[model samples]
Target: MITLDNVSKKYQTRDKGWFTAVEPTSLHINQGEIFGLMGYSGAGKSTLLRLINLLERPDTGKVLIDNQDLTAMSEAQLRQARQNIGMVFQQFNLLSNRTVAENVAFPLEIAGWDAAKIAQRVQECLEIVDLTERAQHYPAQLSGGQKQRVGIARALAPNPKVILA
Candidate 1:
């Protein structure tokens, strides 16, 4: 379902100049399978994930999701394609200003879903993560696990096909 062809990422630093974060790595992730990228903290695992989501462009090679070359897509096209992908961060990046329900509805807002539809989806997602009762609570009010659950709900709000967490 996902293919990385000779992907490499490089970063330019002020003092260090250009450094290769990820080498020419080729990987394939099939449908209905679990894949793991294990390495040390600075081992480029997170960089690879960023490449998959197009949050960070690869220096060389290509990223293909379901056979569509994302590296060749336009900015608008890439944005649309990213709707099918969901991501959760290890830091649980929840909006402190919004309630749980509103946080879950943020992506739907960007996708131009109507109020009624967003409300319905947000409710369903909160219920899925067992946070329906806390829908009105802000992120600061929740524990670490609860905050992560809200993040998961927000990420899943768009009904994505691939989840990157």
Candidate 2:
């Protein structure tokens, strides 16, 4: 479970203007349930999500994940905790120069997985997204949906518990 209790974020401009991005917001998300944060651009949805991951610290209140306070964790602890959360952008950010397999292997490489494990995971992820046949194909060769599928596969390769869309 994830809980945001009276969380808020503020940005101070050079001109001494204070912008309140996320107000004192409180929310709860249950495990095994798909929760969504929806809004138009600049509605602070992204900021709220960032707060949950401690990508940006809240100015007030707390962010708790699975009953553990994420806001109180150290930077290293936050990084480790963030591993269980996956994020996908609206734009499919695949590397055009790399093959589908390579793109899927990127995250594993960042997490310091061995080459053999990377290869195995890439294969499994590709299969999960029904893109095994397109393993050697570059992003340019695939359709938009196919590219997004590759992104999803890459995000899931780490076995994240929470997916931030």
Per-candidate local distance difference test: 0.93, 0.87
Give the range of the ten consecutive residues with the poorest summed lDDT in model 1: 28-37
- Model 1 agreement with the true structure over 57-109: per-residue lDDT tens digits: 99999999989899999999999999988898888888889999999999999
Worst 10 residues of 2 by lDDT: 83-92
Candidate 2 per-residue C-alpha lDDT over 1-165 given as tens digits, one digit per residue, 9 for 90 to 100: 889999999999899999999999998989998888788899898888778888789999999888889889888898788788876656778888999999888878888899998889889888999999999999999999998998899888888888776
For model 1, the superposed segments whose C-alpha errors exceed 4 Å read none
Error of 2 at 96 (Å): 5.0
RMSD to true structure for each model, in Å: 1.3, 2.3
| Deviation in Å, model 1, residue 88 alpha carbon | 0.6
Q: Evaluate model 1: give its TM-score.
A: 0.94
